[model samples]
Structure formats: C-alpha cells, structure tokens
Target: MQVSPVDDSLEQTELRGPRARTRKLMLDTAIALMQKGQTPSISDVAEAAQVSRATAYRYFPSQAALVHAVVDAGLGPILEWHSDSNDAEVRVQDLLKTSMPRILEFEATFKAALKLSLEQWAERQAGTFGDEPPFKRGHRVEMLQKAIAPLKHTLTEFQFQRLAKSLSLVYGLELLLVLKDMWGLEFEETQDIAAWTAGALVRTAIAEAGV
Candidate 1:
C-alpha cells in the first residue's frame, strides 16, 4: 500500500500528540498573560499551564519570541480577512462587519501587543535591544489598496488619497470603540455602515472630480 507523503507527515505529527498539545497550552497561556500587559516568566506560564519549564522553553526560547507569538495570535483573524472576498470593496465591508467586532472584543489585548512591540522597537532604535518590531505598516497599506482598487476609477490622484485616508480613519480603533461601546451598534449594523460609507465616499469623489 502506498501512503501519500503529506498524510505520512500528518500521521507522524499526530503520533506526537501529547507533546504538541503541551506546546499549544504553553502558547495559549502565555498569550493570555501577555494580553494583560504582563509577560509570563517561564516558570509562571509552565506552572499555570500545568506544563513543565523545559516544555515551555522548548517552544519559546525568549520573552521576545513569546511576545511575538501573542501579537500573531491577536492579529490572526484580521490576517485571515485577506482571503474573504475577491472584490476590494466587498472584502473591506466584510472585514469591517466581521473582523472588527472580533478585534474590538479584544481591543485591549491588541493594544497591549502593540504597546509591547512599539516599546521594543524604540529600544532597538536606541541600540539597546536586538528584536525587530511586530508587523509592518506597509502590509496594512497594501491591503487597503487592494480593498480600494475597485473604486479607483471614481477618484483622481489627490481625491483617491483623501478617500483612502477617510476610509482608514473613519474605520479606526477609536471610531469602532465609540460605535460599539457608546452607540451600541451591533456588528451587522457596522457592516452596513461600512458598505454605505464606502459607496458614499466613492460617489462623492467621483462627483467632485467632475467624472
């Protein structure tokens, strides 16, 4: 009988189940600790997760590596949002409606991750640290451009920049917090607002361009 290479590899990984589960537990526990603006000591995370210090250290060699894991965990959903839709506008609207709430629900978690990374970045800049910052602003801008490409025909160069800035700003963390916390707007409602807002911005830009 012939076994597929992929399936063979999967079987080997599955056979190492207990060790894999322990690693996942360590990572999850570490992320929970980091979300609270506290980094986990190796012993602390291992004890809390009911794993061993050796196990935790095997997965995350340093505090920076563990912090990077937490940052990736928090941004996982948004990273997956890139594959949601083919059209840029639909993708943005869908992301706004769906991922926004998930992001907001753990806004403090994301904020903590960002703060940790930024502090590390500053330290590196001052030649006191060795780790690189998590995530790049360029990735976000490219994603934004993908979402706005469909509306480009409706905007001039300057107007497109204005529209892009408005969309990014209006749909930011602050506005999201106000809408969800103060106005009590539901996730679905936010999706509607995002779609309508994008459409309005496109129309306005087109009109202004005399197109």
Candidate 2:
C-alpha cells in the first residue's frame, strides 16, 4: 500500500497519541509474526497486541490493509530513497545496492505479503474475494520510474516505460526470492547479481536508444 503524498500527509495528521500508539503496536506485532513466517490476520495481530478485535478492525479494516501496512513498515528507508546522480545506470545500480540489503532483512515479511497477494488473486479469480480490498503491489513501478528518470529525455515514452518494467524484474522481493531461494546464492551474491542485471538493462536500453 504505497501511499500518495496526499495520503501520507493525511495519515500523519490523523495518527496522534493513542491512535498512533495503537497503530504502531498492531504494525509491530504483525511484523514480528511475519518475521516468524506467519501470515497473521487482523485478528491475530489484535490478539498478539492484546487489543480487542474491534479496535484492530478499526485500525485495519481487512487482512489486505493489515498486510499492506506491514509491507510499508518493512519498506522503511527504501520507500524514501533518492539519488543526486543524473545518470540512469548509476541511479539504478545505487537503488538496487541500497534497497537489496533492506529487502533481505525483511525477506520473510515480504514473502508473507506475497503469499497474501497470491491468495487474494486466487480468491478473486474464484469469485470468493467478497468485499476485501485488493492488496495493491506496485511500489516498484514508481521507484523504478524514479530510478531511470534521467533516461526520459533519451528514450521515447514507450522505451522508458519498457526499461523501467525490465528493471522491475530484477528488483524487490522477487529478485531476492529467486536468486537466493532457487539458486542457493548468498546475500552478497544475490545483491551483486541484481545490481549487475539492473545496470546491464539500463545500459542496454540506452544503447538501443542510440543515446
């Protein structure tokens, strides 16, 4: 649940005193449970935080909302990342190098979020999704676009968007999960591979653009 600037401002305005504390408690509890490899529900978080279900529901109306909040909390510094460099390749590399370690740290939590996302997708396909809010999962789109922003002038809009989408393949939880879990690579190896792949994609896109 990557919030817009307006939503961020509204959230800051609303979260105060007991409200903030309660929300923090729920979020922290969810993160802990997720770290332990449990995809906890709102009820689970409320129980673990020793708050009533009603209070928990008031904070997180559905499981998707709860998981989205947990994902946002886990994102931390990656969500606020910026680069002073104007070079797209360098920016993409820096973004990968900076974000991968944090992603690894919260690997379990992110995997739980992925599981919930898949579950929601399956339920929706089967027409059993009911009224649950869909778990939105495109924070990488914005981040990747920002990472390769310098290329906008060099590449056409289609090329720029395509490059950003290509970079997304080697970023975030999916990259870590694939390179580490499937290939048995260590953290350093995974990070190096992701950064190399991202840089290669950017360079390839620029070359193809004749820039």
Q: Which prediction has the highest lDDT against the true structure?
A: 2
| Poorly placed runs, candidate 1 (over 4 Å) | 1-8, 11-16, 37-44, 50-54, 82-87, 131-139, 149-166, 170-211
Point out where model 2 deviates above 4 Å. 1-16
* TM-scores, each model vs. reference: 0.62, 0.93
Cα misplacement distance, residue 57 of candidate 2 (Å) = 1.0
- Across 42-91, the per-residue lDDT of candidate 1 in tens digits comes to 68788989877787889877766676666667767665555445455566
Top candidate on TM-score is 2
Q: What is the C-alpha lDDT of each candidate?
A: 0.66, 0.90
Q: Residue 29 CA error for candidate 1 (Å)?
A: 0.6
- Local error of candidate 1 at residue 201 (angstroms): 4.8
